[model samples]
Target: MDFLENVVSKERTLNPEERVGEALRQAGVSITITSITDVFAFAIGATTRVPVLRSFCIYTTAGIFIVYVLTLIFMVPILSLDERRRDSGREGCLCLRLPADYKKNRCSQKLLLEVIFRRIFGPLLVKTPVKVVVVLLTMGLLGLNCWGLSGLKNDFDRTWFFNPGYQRDFVSAVQDLFPESGYRADFYLGNTDYFREKEALEELFNRLSALPGIKNGSIEFWHHSFLEYLKEKKGKPIRIMNVSTKAMQLTLTRRPPPMWICKQADILLNSVPPVGAMNHPGKISPGLQYMCANG
Candidate 1:
């Protein structure tokens, strides 16, 4: 659109090819700058961790590249062809020949915005008083923006991602009723020797429990339950040595362990109970799902 406007706004004395070339030259810098900025912005967005936002950015970046290529390779030649048709006194889409006097009758006219900017705003902007007022207004706006930034707070509402429906309404109602309700955070450990690192893991649990803003009595480490189970089974104090034989037996087994044995093994060697499970009182068992280790 800008290219077409530029071509039309050029001097009527120029030929079709000259008008097209001049328009391309005039519009190239602005178009290139805008396309580069847009592509760069979306490229940064593509690196975001959020799945929806990353996908959106990736598709939009591809679209911008495609459109930029089409503008140069396709739009320019089409505009040149249209300009040629106009110059030869042919109708715009149909190419029907018009009267020979049509070219002479048609006069090049300035756009309304171009006329206003050249006649009124251009001269007014140069006057000393007008320049002073413009500077003062710009400074005032800058100060006001800074003042607004000081009061701005960052917040995210999960409901913002959902459309207006029963689900969104329910979530908004819950948030309004329980503004202090906690959300879940999951942590995973890989290739850990839970038997050797028991003290380290216990210290980690204690540190998590000591953190401010954590709800009291919400930390649920599976080791705590396993310890109690062992105390009940052996009628002795909970210690890693008591389970050494069972751990060895499981490790030396040729066949896969039973489901209950697998669950116990997962709790002993791999799992840590979720920290904030108490927040969801209605949930019967809110912990990591245990999977059996393959033999």
Candidate 2:
């Protein structure tokens, strides 16, 4: 639209081809700069870790690039054709030849808004008093925006991205019913010797549980179930006790020493069972055995 306006504003003495060439010469730098700026700005979004945002950015960047290319390739010829149509006194789209008087009158007349801006508003805006007022108002807005930034809370609501469907309704219902449990963060432990670092792992879990906004008994580590199984089988209370070398050997061999351990392993591998009736089932538990096996 801006490119077409630039072409149309060229001297009436110039032909359509000359006007197009002149418009490109005058507006090319600005067009290129703005398009490049927008492309780079959206390209930055591609670096985000969120899959949806990253994909959006990637597609938007490509789209902007393609549109920019198309504009350069096609707009000049289209603008030249429109300019010829205007010069021939033909109505746009309809291609009807307009009356000579009407064409002349239209060509000579200026738009009321353009006239008002040029003669009144534009001149008034340049005056010292109005300029000072404008600067003050702009600064006031800037200050308010900066103050508002301090109160901005960073949050992600997955429901906002969902369309109107069963998935969206289900998520909305869950969020309404259990606001605290709606959003969660998963922590992964990799390549650690759980037998040796059991205490450290427990301390880490306890600290995570103690953090503000973490629901009580919400932390689920498969090691907890393994500990329970050991306590029951060995007929003793257990807290941070490293398993015996024989038990460790059994674990390494995938035998687990007992049918009960195998049953517990199946449960651990499938999902992290709830700690108690009050707690929600842990959805993020990748079993210790799975992690160790992969690592």
Please tell me which predicted candidate would have the highest lDDT against the true structure: 2
Model 1 Cα lDDT, one tens digit per residue, 1-295: 6665666766788877788888878888898999999999999999876667889999999999999999989988988888889777788668999976654423355367778999999999999999999999999999999999999996656667899999899977866786565443344445455555656655666675665645556545554444555566568786555456344334323232233353443343222232111111111112212211111
Please give each candidate's TM-score: 0.62, 0.57
lDDT score, candidate 1: 0.64
| Residue 81 displacement in candidate 1 (angstroms) | 1.2
lDDT of 2 by residue, 1-295 (tens): 5555655665767888888888888888898999999999999988877788889999999999999999988976888888889888898879899986773556546568778999999999999999999999999999999999989996766677789999999978876896656354456554455556667766776666665655666656655655666788779986666565446435434555444443343222222222111112222232121111011
Model 2 has an lDDT value of 0.67
- Evaluate all candidate structures by whole-model CA lDDT and list the values in order: 0.64, 0.67
lDDT of 2 at 196: 62
Question: What's model 1's lDDT at 94?
Answer: 83
TM-score of candidate 2 relative to the true fold: 0.57
Which ten residues in a row are the worst by lDDT in model 2? 286-295
Model 1: residues >4 Å from true position, as ranges?
Answer: 1-18, 103-110, 164-181, 185-295
Instruction: State the RMSD for candidate 1.
Output: 9.2
